[model samples]
Target: MAGKLDRFEKLINSLSTWLNWVAGVGLVTMLALIVADIIGAKLFKWPIPGGIEMVGFLGVVVATFAIAQTQFLHGHIEVEFVVTKLPKTAQKVISCLTYSLGMALFALLSWQSFEFGRTLQTSGEVSMTQEIPFYPLAYSMGFCCIVVFLVLLVQCIMTMIRAKK
Candidate 1:
């Protein structure tokens, strides 16, 4: 059982890392697009079409896609100033509880995102400038949220095992 969990953890970690890379690429692309748009507008008196809309979409991608890996790295801010002072058992209990809450929150977000994506798809919603379908971006948000939820679930289970020991 432990071995299986370990394997699963590794798999999730790898996926998170890959997603992080994708986020990095998205960030860079967004930056380039902004710069190019500015240069075109200033120098050539012609701005990139749909540039603002693309940036907005890329912003969402960069933000949502990076969260899972951040969770996996335990990189999110935490007020451990108080938690660290607790006894070992209490600390483990708190960790478990924290991860449990995170899992729940992200699970809800994931479900809602997917539902919103489906609604967008059914309604044929699209972006104003590019006319790009909104559903794919919504679906991607849902995917990222699920990844974060899984990361939290693994942390919660690990904390439980430690508490048991």
Candidate 2:
């Protein structure tokens, strides 16, 4: 079971790494677009059309898509002073609980985001400036949420197993 869990962890880490790379690309693209828009607006007295909208979309991509990788890396902030003082088993229990809570929250977020995306799709909702469809980005958010939720669920399971041992 440990071996299986480790292999699953490796697979999830690989997928999260790929998502992080894609998020990096999105960030770079957003930066380039913003720079170009600034230059065009200031120097050429003509702003790049839909530049803001494009950057906004890319920002969502960069932020949402990196969440799974960030969780995998344990990059999020933690207040460990109290947890560290607890016995090892207690700490593991607390960790499991925390991860369970996180999984639940993200799962809810994923479901709600998917529903919102569907609503947007049905309504033909779009950005005012670029007329860019909103559903795709919402769907991306939902996907990312699922990825994070899966990561947390795995962590919760691992913690429970460790606590038992």
Candidate 3:
């Protein structure tokens, strides 16, 4: 059981690393697009259509997809004042509980986001500027949320296991 769990952790870590890289690429692309748009508007006097909307979408993708990596790196915000003073066992328990709640919240958000995306897709919703379909991007956000939730769940379980030991 321990070996299996260890293997699962490794798999999740690998997947998170790949996702982090993808998110980094997305961030860079978004930055480049924004800079180009700015330069075009300021210097060339020609702004790209729907540039803001595109950047917004890319930003969401970058942020959401990077969540797992952030958690894996312990980069998420932590109010550690009390936690840091607690006993090791208590700290582990609190960490497990915190992550469990986070998992639940993200799961709920993913479900609602998916439903919203489906409704938009069914209604053929499009962005105001370029008439770009918004549903696919929304659904992708939901998918990223799901990935983050799964990563949190794995972390929660791992913490529980460690607490036992």
Candidate 4:
């Protein structure tokens, strides 16, 4: 079981790491786009059309895609000062509870995002300036949220296993 869990964890971590790379790319792209936009607007007097909309979309990609990797690395903050004072068992319980809540929250976000993406696709919703389809971004958010949910689930399971020992 431990071996299986370790393998699964590795797989998820690898996927998360890949997603993190994508987030970094998105961040860099956003930076370049904004810089170009600023330069064009100020110097050339020809700003990139839909630059703002593109930046907003890339921001979402950067934020969402990095979440799983962050969670996997225990990079997210927790009020550990209070939790550390508790008994070991209580700490484990609290950890499990929090992870469960995170799983639930991310799962719901994934579901709702998918539903919204479908709606957007069906309605042909798009950005005003770029006319870029909204559904792809919504779908990306949904996928990223699922990755977060998976991370939480793995942590929750590990916590439970530790509690049993």
Candidate 3 lDDT at 105 equals 90
Ordered list by lDDT, greatest first = 4, 1, 2, 3
Write the residue-wise lDDT of candidate 3 on 117-160 in tens digits: 99999999998998989898778778877777878878888888
Candidate 1, 110-161: lDDT as tens digits: 9999999999999999999899999999999999999999999998898898
User: Model 1, 10: alpha-carbon shift in Å?
Assistant: 0.6
Every candidate's lDDT: 0.94, 0.92, 0.86, 0.96
Q: Of the pair 1 and 2, which is ahead by lDDT?
A: 1
Question: Candidate 4 residues 1-165, lDDT tens each?
Answer: 999999999989999999999999999999999999999999999999999999999999999999999999999988899999999999999999999999999999999999999999999999999899999999999999999998998999999999999
- Better model by lDDT: candidate 2 vs candidate 4: 4
User: Which numbered prediction scores highest in lDDT against the true structure?
Assistant: 4
lDDT of 4 at 77: 87
Which candidate, 1 or 4, would have the higher lDDT against the true structure? 4
Worst 10 residues of 1 by lDDT: 156-165
Candidate 3: deviation at residue 51, Å? 1.1
